[model samples]
Target: MPNFNNLQYASEPGSPTSPSEDWAQATADLIVVLDGATARTETGCSHGISWYAEHLGKSLLLAAADTTLSLVGVAKSAISRVACLHPECDLTHPGTPSAGIAMLRPDGRYFVLGDVAIVAESTDGIAVIVDERVSQTGVAERAEVDHYLIGTPEKAAALLPMKRAELAARNIPGGYWIAAADPAAADHALVGHLGLDDGAPVAVLTDGAARAEVFGLLDWAGLLDLAVAAGPLELIQRVRAAENSDPLGAKWPRNKASDDATMVTASVAS
Candidate 1:
């Protein structure tokens, strides 16, 4: 078996202070990333996505600590706990706060929900683990907004409407799902294992941080290299720098100018 190395991590909001809505935490054997969705309209849950993400992360960590619970079970426990915190709010609100989750554990098991990702580097190249079902969603407003030029005022103007549409499609048939008030969403999560004997490196990231690679700024190999050499936060900084240079999103079209970013890197062992 490959001797495991230390796990390192970094996280930052797209902007200052409002609490980024992106959450990440790592232990010697456990790593997790959570990306909270932006609300289209105000949901009854006044706690906000950032607070929801933070609470959910804590609950998930607590759930994961229970050796007897399966990953799905852990997700259920977390969801239940978070839901309980907002009994007075409409948990079923279309705009209810939710988050995508990506986590790795000592058992070589991996769990994924929504767009948060886990990329594994092997001798051959890189393999990305993502739940792409979100794309298959047929939300017309989102599709229409997606057709707009990114970084343009038109795209910016359409965001709220598009977000409203996204909510309509979430957790429903033919729509993408995430960790929301319902624990049932966890049943829809993706779970699997990695063999540590190969000593492959895995990088767990929130969508914002992974956007750099998506925008072609860095290849998977290059991203991994930078993470090891300069640290994961550098990758995010580089992305921010690139974004800064093109504040208008003219060079690269994307939904937002900046996003909450987080990354965790580790070499797993059996």
Candidate 2:
């Protein structure tokens, strides 16, 4: 059997007033992860990330509890419910809701979506299971801008027409799971495994922590490795130190430079 443990945290790096990002977990020899979409409207009264995140997290738990539907089914149902409740959410087209999810199941099956990563830890090293939508690949890219920004039924229809087609164009890397981007709601990719008989630690993290450069720093993998070797408190301090080292004049390219970062690390007992 696999033993599981998780840690959750939230931070408001950019705006002092709006703390929209949400995180949640459910353990049953498996784990589910989600990142709600940041709201597009500036004055929509809490219409952005937090609303979707809270709904997605609760919906995921409901799906896990329901026996009739598969994980994917539960997620789709949840998206529908969310859409109904928040009529303002433009889910019809290629709009990507808050992204990424990984379900670790007892049957050894794992399903993942988008950029949220699933990495297997072993004596050799750590390897990522989810690949970011953007990379070195030079393939043509399409954006469903309307889908993401739509507010009306006619606008959503017009904007979303190319959503399925756009999603079809992207190429997924090997060993990485992908969920087709949905303009109005969340996207989910399913994966399964027989259980980590290998006896290594497992990690699922949001892109903020996993991104190679955050606030102008590189070698995030190196930092994660050190954190794994050291204790959690040491890891936190190390991150703090790195963030502090940035000179004021130096510009950080990240949109959410001081983003809300979260990670869940688990290992099978000896």
- Measured against the true structure, the TM-scores of the candidates, in listed sequence, are 0.91, 0.63
* Local accuracy of candidate 2 as per-residue lDDT tens digits, 2-100: 455443222222235667363647474556666544433232333556666767667667766775766676666665665566666444333434445
Off by over 4 Å in 1: 1-4, 122-125, 138-140, 146-153
Writing each residue's lDDT as its tens digit, candidate 1 over 1-270 gives 233466778888887756798898887667878999877588878789989999999999999888788888989999999999889889878888999998877556778999998877754457677888775664566666666666567787788877766777899877788999999998888898765444567788988888878889998778877886678889999988988887766677667678899998877665
lDDT by candidate, in order shown: 0.81, 0.49
Clashes of each: 0, 18
Cα displacement (Å) at residue 158, model 1: 1.3
Error at 246, model 1, angstroms: 1.3
TM-score of 2: 0.63
